[model samples]
Target: MQPIALITSPFTDKFSIPRQPGLAPSVISTVSFVGDFDHTASIEGIQQYSHLWLIFEFNQHRSHQWRERVRPPRLGGNKQLGVFATRSPFRPNNLGMSVVKLVDVVVKPQIKLVVSGADLLDQTPIVDIKPYVPYVDAIPEASSAFAGDEPNQLEVCFSATAEAFIDELTSNAAKSEHYQNLRQVIIEVLRQDPRPAYHASKQPERHYVSQLYDLELNWYVTGQCLTITEIRQQKDF
Candidate 1:
C-alpha cells in the first residue's frame, strides 16, 4: 500500500513560530490538509484527544544534506553528536516531530484545525498527525541524556503597564482562554531563556514580542532577570 500525507501550518511566517512546543503555548498554529485531503471526516474522532503528535517536514532546512553527526543548540552548539540523538533539522529526510495541544477543529469549506503549543513555522507541511496517548507514551523514568538536568530557576518580573495590558486582555470574555494560556506559555518559555547560551554573558536589555492566535506578548530581559511586560490581542501587533 502507498503511504500518503498532508502538510499545513497556522503561522504567517517563520519569525513568529517557536523553536519548540510548550515553549510558546500562547503561539497557536494551524494544520490544514493538501488538496482532496481537506475534509472533516479525515479527523472525525480527533476532538476526543486533547493532544496530538505532529509529523512534519523540515522544509526550510531541506537544502542541507544529511550528516552522520550534528550539533545541538541545547548542548551549546560546541559538540558534534549523532544525528538520531538530537532533534536537528538537518537530516536525511528533513522530518520533524512535535507534540501539540488540540484546541479545535473546523469543518466547512474545508477541514481546518486550531492547535496550540505548535513549534512549526507558518505554512509548514504536515506529514502525519496521530493522537497522543499519555498513558502509554508518558515515561516519567525516561532519562534525558546529554540534554542534562533542567536549567536553573530564572526570575521573571512584569512592569506595571505590562500587567495592566495582560489584565485587560484576560478580562475580555472573547479572549480570556487564549489570554490565560498564552500568558503561562510565554512565561514558561522565557524562564528557559531562549537565547543562545554563549550570549549569557551579554546582559544587554532586550525585548521580545511573541504571539500565537489571539494573544500577543511583549517581554524583555535584563541580566538574569526576565520580564513579561505586555499581553494583548494579535491585532494589537
Candidate 2:
C-alpha cells in the first residue's frame, strides 16, 4: 500500500518512544499529517475512539537490513533470541505498532492530533490507524516473561537550578500547563533508567541528555541509578 503522508511530532526522536504508552503520560505530542488531503473529513469519527493503534514506519532503522535474532533491552542486552519474540525495531518491514491515547483532534488545513504516550519520533510516516477494542484487546491473564512483574519505581530529586528553571517556565501564562506536564513526564521516563544493562557499569557521574517536546534533559548516573539534574528548553541546547 502507498503511504498517504508523513506524521511528525516534537515529543521524541525515533529512539525515545517508550515500549508502551501510559508508561509516560506526561509526554504530550502532536501528529501533523503531511501533503494535501481533506484533514477535517478524514478524522470525522476519530473522536469516538479513546485509543488508536498507530502503524508507523521505523524510520531510524529503514536503511538497515533486518536481523533474524536480536537482543532485548529487558533481557539485560545480552543473549540472543528470535526476532519475532522481541519488539526490536530491526524488522524486515521496518514498521512499529503503538497504542496511544487520543486526547484531542483539531481539523484545519491539516489534521493535528494530540496524542499521549506515543513512542514515535518526529516526522515518522504513519502507515495506518485503527481503533482499539477493549473486548478483543484486553488480556488480563497474559503473562510477561522478560518484562518481570511490576515496574520498579525510582526516587527522583531535581537540582536547584533545574527547579528554578521549571518554576520560570511554569509561571509563564502561555506555556505553564504544557511545561508542567512535560517536566513530570520526562522525569518519570528518565528515572526508570534508559541505559543499556551492559553499560550499567560505566562511570556513575556521567550525564545523559534526552529531548522531549521543547525540553532538553540533563541527567546523571549514580550507583547504577539515573537521576535528572537539569531540564531546559531545546532552544538553549
Candidate 3:
C-alpha cells in the first residue's frame, strides 16, 4: 500500500521505544500527510476522536526474513511463540499498528497531526489512519496468557550532573516549553528498563547509550535502580 503520511517521532531508534503504545504517554509524534493525501479536508472530522489507530510499516525490519516463531519481550525474550500471537516487527508484510492519543490536528498549515503515546520510529511511513472507536475496539473480555499484566518498572534516577544539564536545557525561554516535559519522558522510558533481556541478566552493571530525540542518554542499571550518568546532544557527539 502507498504511504498516506509519515511520522516524525521522538524515538530516533528502536532501542528506547516502548513495547506498546501508551506505555510512555509523554512521547509525542507528528504525522504529516504526503502526496495526494495532504489535503486538510481528508482529516476534517479527525478532531472528533480522542485517539487514532496508525497503520505503519516496520520499514527498518523489512529486509529481515520473517519468522514463524519469535521471542516476545514480555516473556523476557527467552520463550518462543508464534509470530501471529505476538507483536513482533518481523512479519511477512512488516506492518505494525499503534493506538495513539490525538493531541491536536492542524489544518491551516497543511495537514498535520500531533499525537502522543506513539511507538513509531522517526520518519516511519503511515499507510492508513483510523479513528479508535471505543465501543467496539475495546473489548472487556480480552485476555492474553503471555502478557497478562504490565511489566514491572525500575526506579529511574539521574546523577547531579545529569540534572544540572537538563536544568540548563530547559532554562532558555526558546527551548523551555518544548523541553519542559523532556525529563518526564526520559524517566518514563528509563524506568521501563529498555534493555535486551540477555543484557539485563548478563551485564546488569554495564553502561549503555540510548537516543531520544537529539539527546544521547548514558545510563546503567544496578539492582532495581536505573541511573542516568549523563545526557549529551547528538551534535556534540
Error of 2 at 230 (Å): 2.7
lDDT, candidate 3, equals 0.90
Clashes per prediction? 7, 2, 0
Off by over 4 Å in 1: 1-19, 160-185, 202-220, 228-237
* Global Cα lDDT for candidate 1: 0.70
Off by over 4 Å in 3: none
Clashing pairs in 2: 8-123, 17-119
lDDT of 2 by residue, 1-237 (tens): 545456555556534455565678666767776665435767778899999888888878868999999998777788889889888989999987888899888777568888887766777788788898888887888887887564555566688898888888878878775565655776667766766667666555566787776677788776735567888777732
Tens digits of per-residue lDDT, candidate 3, 42-126, equal 9978999999999999999977999999999888889999999999998999999999999988876568999999988999999
Candidate 3 residue pairs that clash: none
* TM-score per candidate: 0.73, 0.88, 0.97
Model 3: lDDT of residue 95:
93
TM-score for model 2? 0.88
Per-residue alpha-carbon lDDT of candidate 1 for residues 1-237, written as tens digits (9 for 90 to 100): 111334344344454455567666665666766566776678889999999998888778867899899877677767989999988888888888999999988787657778877777766778788999999989888888876565554687878877777677778888675445545655665676666555565645656666545456677777678877776665742
